[model samples]
Target chain A: MPAKELIRLSGLTKTYGQGDAAFQALKGIDLSINVGEFVAVMGHSGSGKSTLMNILGCLDTPTSGVYAYENIEVQKLETNQRSMLRRHALGFIFQGFNLLARTSALENVELPLLYRGLTRGKRHEMAEKALRSVGLPDKLRNKPSELSGGQQQRVAIARAIVTNPITLFADEPTGNLDSSTTHEVMTLLTQLNREKGITILMVTHEDDVASYADRVVCLSDGNILSDTLNNRKNNK
Target chain B: MTWNAFLIALREIRRNLTRAFLTVLGIIIGVASVITMVTLGDGTTKALQQQISSLGSNMLMIRPGMGFGPRSASAGIPNFTMDDVEAIREQIDNISAVAPVSSSQMGTIYMQEARSSSITGTTLEYFSINNWTLAEGRYFSSSEATSGAAVGVIGDTVRKELFNGEDPIGKKIRVGSSVIEVIGLLKAKGQVGMGDQDDCIMVPINTVQRRITGYTSMHNIGTICVSAVEGTDSDKLVADISSLMRQRRNLQPNQDNNFNVFDTRQIADTLSSSTKTMTTLLAAVAGVSLLVGGIGIMNIMLVSVTERTREIGIRLSIGALAREVLLQFLVEAITLSCIGGIVGILLALVICLGLSQLIDIPFAFNIQINMISFIFSATIGVLFGYAPARRASRLDPIDALRHE
Candidate 1:
């Protein structure tokens, strides 16, 4: 298939609070993410990067804007519809590796598939495959506390991708990991993006983490400061 | 969602065993207390009814007094003698048998030793009226009663106390310095109407009145036992006997009947109804404890919601519907209470068993009531758990994720 836009946003603006206490988090953001693209969003603290990620991940709605995923306007969707969209179309990876404590890796991966109402057999099959893809097949029965930080993030990734969603949204996916584990997680993400053709959006403050992406976008004070395609990295 | 998540939740509950047990304790105590109270109350009522029935269903007691009150000095108590008993027997239509008894606790002789026992002076009609049967020998004859002979029947308790397992029939016993031959030994009558029938020694009424007490007329007759004729309306019989006694005493129409008449069946009904009322009142009080248990569940669920804030955020972010989260927590609360209720029922059963063995009353454990209580407690868990579950479900994912 031709390069189709999986996520599209136009003139997106999000404001917290109201009247005198009003604060704008995102200012007229316009962006499009194509299918199978690995894009990185970089910004300083309080630079609207996290707000854009939140909107992109469907965790929040923009104060004023149009957000469309796969040709469907997400801002106008109902609460249940948004939940369904998140389950069937978009996946999220948090910086804290927000895996349920005391839950096994396979069960964590099966969480999203449970919302999809899959049968027990089918859920196990999908969760096993997802864990295997993240290179943690042996850690399926281990809880998050038992796994290394990178292993926990892999379990989180397995959970996000188990539903085979249209877009994967990762916010500082390696923020809690050391340099070695960060590289290992980023390599896994790169391999998943290239081999499975899954669209990836990553947010980070580290330039080294952003360097793994095919395209990099920088934001400052609620405005996009740069949007550049990495032709050299793409060629390599 | 997946059964795995439910399994995980259950596992988590098991892991925090102490908290789970504490959470269920309220329900356990509430259910157990209800069951114990109901079982014991039912048993006592049944025992009382049985005791009343054993006294003869149609038997009525008539005593010379204004209802049940203290005896007054100015009240001219009518004498109930062999003549009055004969008069009532010959005059009344519903009277099947009449026994005019004069009783006193006398220092009597049994096996050559003096012992304290009741002496009742009455006719042979007393045997049939009180459903008494002879264990050995025969009752006093009408000739012996009329001739004022000193023949008497001894109850089983008196026989045991006096003879010490030997036969007392044809043996002579002394009552208040008067020697009387035991004509028979009565069959064991456990106890009836607050008095031990087995401890009494019966003699001819005229003989006891003339020889032992040295009185020709007895003022206070130990309750006159009357049995109604077959197919006769007992209430009407009682009313007729009351009127006849009043006329015999020469009371005016406006005056209250000077004698108190109590029917065994009526007393039984009254006792049962009162017991039913008491059971209902105790159940209502126990129900209040169940309500408090529900409130305890709600309070704990609220705290659980607060504690699991981050977990709720994680689940929501992973595509869990708000209603799904609500339902999971609700199920958890219900599970806790249902487990507690089951334990309570078992405890109640054990308690009922212990009570039946320990007390004189028969305690019955109604399975239907126990089941109803169990279901009621589970429902309370659900009803109370809803608010906290809803609060957790409606939480903003971003804010919840940020919650410490």
Candidate 2:
């Protein structure tokens, strides 16, 4: 990769269970992700794609590997240090949106900023900016139950990016949305990547969802089967 | 992590209004009951002490006996004569007033109609020594006391019973076949430690000795009322009386005194100390209720921790520090207890005020007890709240998130 790399993993391995019953989730996988790269990881069930995403997001440590983020060795970080890294450098979007119900969208976005030690006024201001950037400025006062599926996902996205983290991790971000809303959300993500140069690493099972990314890496049986670049015209 | 989190936690408590109220009810009842009982006990003790002190601190009582020794039903002790009273007055240094009292169970008293009452015979100084005041007529003269005259004073209850609301002063009341004219009606003095003071008729000592009981000398001198001189040594006065009685009876140094000399002030001190000990015991029993309330808080908090596992996970995953989680839950528990304590204090005040009005004893509102109850309830919150808060904070985010 010519561009500056943001994540590099070498000899990454994850094993579960004991002795003879041990099953490896990720076996000796090596990968590099460059800055501002829009990558999608596609896999069948039990293919270790989720494990890779977890290691990439600093949520899990590889049992035997050297995982580096922007030249910093992530595997050696303490538990609190790993959490701090996740707080300062990573944003996450889950398939279920995972937004706390009965909470306003603004408050939902303010959650991450609250942990950053920002004052009330500054936290609210940053939350409003993030929600506005996600094109939901008018929905700040609305709760998760009051918003549509696509609007709720946008609030989740705003919450993810409120801390201005270095990389965005979306695990099946549009899996629960309708076909039309899926296209709408994908266009929004693509625009965020092109306009703001924010790195996007997404995991999805659907080929159509993976096609929205600039590059795709496919996995089967805990091994990367293919890595390809797309030449399609920009959809947005 | 920030004050906003605390504000949010407070708002959350406000949202669950019913749960919050129910959660604090235990602490409320606990604190209020403690305060009310303590206040009532203190008031009763204060009233008792005040009543005892009002009975004349300088007065001493000399009852017949060898200092309250074992009683002998077969043979009675020698009666105190008029000469014994004179000898004590002559020998004692701080003798202010001396009166010899004799009592008999002459059942019925009659003014116009007949009623039941006890009759007592005493000298003139009995009026001042026992805090008696005449309401309608004059007290008996010293001449009447010496010449064995039939003059008498009637108490308020006796007057009411025999006179039937009519004036009893200067009226002749027939007592046990002897007619004695009432010289004075005593002012309304309420009951003291013994019983109702207004249930007897007073006659001259010589008259009761000569006519009613028909004995040359008084046998049972119920009590010898002695008042100490102002600014003189009361202990020296008691010692002088003891020495003079020893000389009169020709007793050796190893022999016990033949009479009991009790200072009313000492009795007052003894009564107050006993009241204090009783009040403290009652307060300690009431304090157990507060402990039970604390245990209730702990039980409820532990259940809340178990119920909100997923919520804790969500907060933790969203970047909430373990300490922040710990503090949030702890504050919630404390808020519940503090609200309960405040309401309990208010309730206890109202109850104490009502009880004071209904009872004879005064109900004193003590601010120190109120503060202590509040602090105690808050301490209960902190102590009981710790385990649940720690459990919530120490939960594994991944495991908690996956909890169904």
Candidate 3:
């Protein structure tokens, strides 16, 4: 079956401050993401890739743009409505891991499902399955502080996928991980994309990290520099 | 959702156990002191009522005064006479007993024991009216009271001082240079609000007039004691006695009566109400501290919100609504204060029990006040916790996640 369009952004612009102090982070950007696609967004410092990620994740709104997610006018949604949309349809992974310190890994993974009002038993079951998928089944009771960087990131991945979201936004998911741990996390993401058909939009600075994606979009000075498909060996 | 917030709040408080305890200290002290004050006040009022009731049952004291207090002394007013007491005894309805009393402080001696004691002279009805019961010996015969016989009844204190616990019946004790035979020894009536009830001796009014004061007149009676039958409205009784006294004294209708008839029950009520007023005042003063305690909680909660900005960001970013975050913080504050209130109530219980025993008052536990205090403390939590929780909920997820 042909892939379905998941998200579209047209003429998107984000400005901070005013007049002389104003800085435009995204200037007239147009992009389309398809379901089940693994796309990497690459940019240098001051290139506004992170800004685009923020707007796409619904953590922010663009100054003037049309942002449609599954044909829903997300830009016109209220803050609470956007929250509900993010709750049910989107998941996020951060470079810092962002696991709550001193909290058990299982509980951290179960955080999103709490807002979804799932029963405790059901939430526990789903969170455990997600942890097992990320290869941290035995680390369910370990706190973030007690876990290594790679293990913590795995816990973050488990949390992001625990809700079975339609789209996953990973902002430098492997930035803080070692090369070996990076390969392990990238392989896990590849399996989830190719097998589970979960669409992913990732931002990265490293070329090798971008190599995991099926397509690469390079940004420079708040505008797209290149959008190209990548051909990689089926190493997995 | 509320339950989840409650659980989260409990975990947060547990994580910072020491800080939470310190934050609630003010509330604890506030609740404990208010409860203690109100409890002790109730105990004192009860003790006072008990003591006053011991004075007499349904009794009235007709004193030769306009009213009680220093300004109302009957020094310029005429004293009640035996004829007035006689008229009440014969004429009034619902009346049980009547006695005309005259008292003088005099030196009494029995063998080597010498003491200055108050000597009251009244009829046999005085003992019944004042609820006095003799421990031993017999009261005087009617002839002894009528013919001015030199006989006396000594109270417990007088017996202890003059006779040294020895049976003094039929023994002679000199009162103001007159030797009087002790016919009866009164039971120990303990103490009341006025003074020691067992400190005076009672003889016939005629004996006091003829022997002690050397007056030999029937008009020397200082006061009259009257007791009504049970179930008689005391207000009506007072009115009856006043009217009788006014008629016997030949006072004009327009004139203010020269004497006062005091119902002991009314005195008890007045005294009890005053005690209640004092308790309310003390509780109110203690209530001020509860408000201060609420402010303390607010201050710490504000600090807590600032410290947990990043944690709030994480929750917000994970699809938690603003009100959910607000509920979490609000529940935490209310839980903290309610815990403080419970601790305070328990502390007050212990303190009231110990202090009541120390101060010789009844220990009164008022559940109503305790409940009011608890609800008030919880309200304080809500009142003070609102601003901080609202601030937490209104936080921007992106900015909050960026918070260090």
Best by lDDT: 3
Residue-level lDDT tens digits of model 1 in B142-178:
8999988988898888888888877788888888988
Q: What TM-score fits each model?
A: 0.80, 0.72, 0.74
lDDT of 3 by residue, A1-236 (tens): 99899999999999988999999989989999999999999999889998899889988788999999999989999888988888888888999887877789998999889888888899999999999999998999999989999999999999999999889999999999999999999998888899888999999999999999999999998999999998855544
Worst 10 residues of 3 chain B by lDDT: B384-393
Residues B107-219 of candidate 3: C-alpha lDDT, one tens digit per residue: 99999999899999899888888888878998878999988799999999998888886889999999997989998998887777778889888998888988888986677
Model 2: per-residue lDDT, tens digit, B66-86? 664465222555656677787
Better structure of 2 and 3 per lDDT: 3
Candidate 3 residue B397 Cα shift, in angstroms, is 3.1
- DockQ, ranked from best to worst: 1, 3, 2
Per-model DockQ: 0.45, 0.27, 0.44
The root-mean-square deviation over C-alpha atoms between each candidate and the true structure, in angstroms, is: 4.7, 6.0, 5.9
Ranking the candidates on TM-score from highest down gives 1, 3, 2
Superposition error at B216 for model 3 (Å): 6.1
Q: State the C-alpha lDDT per candidate.
A: 0.81, 0.80, 0.86
What DockQ score does model 3 reach against the true complex?
0.44
DockQ-superior candidate, 1 or 3: 1
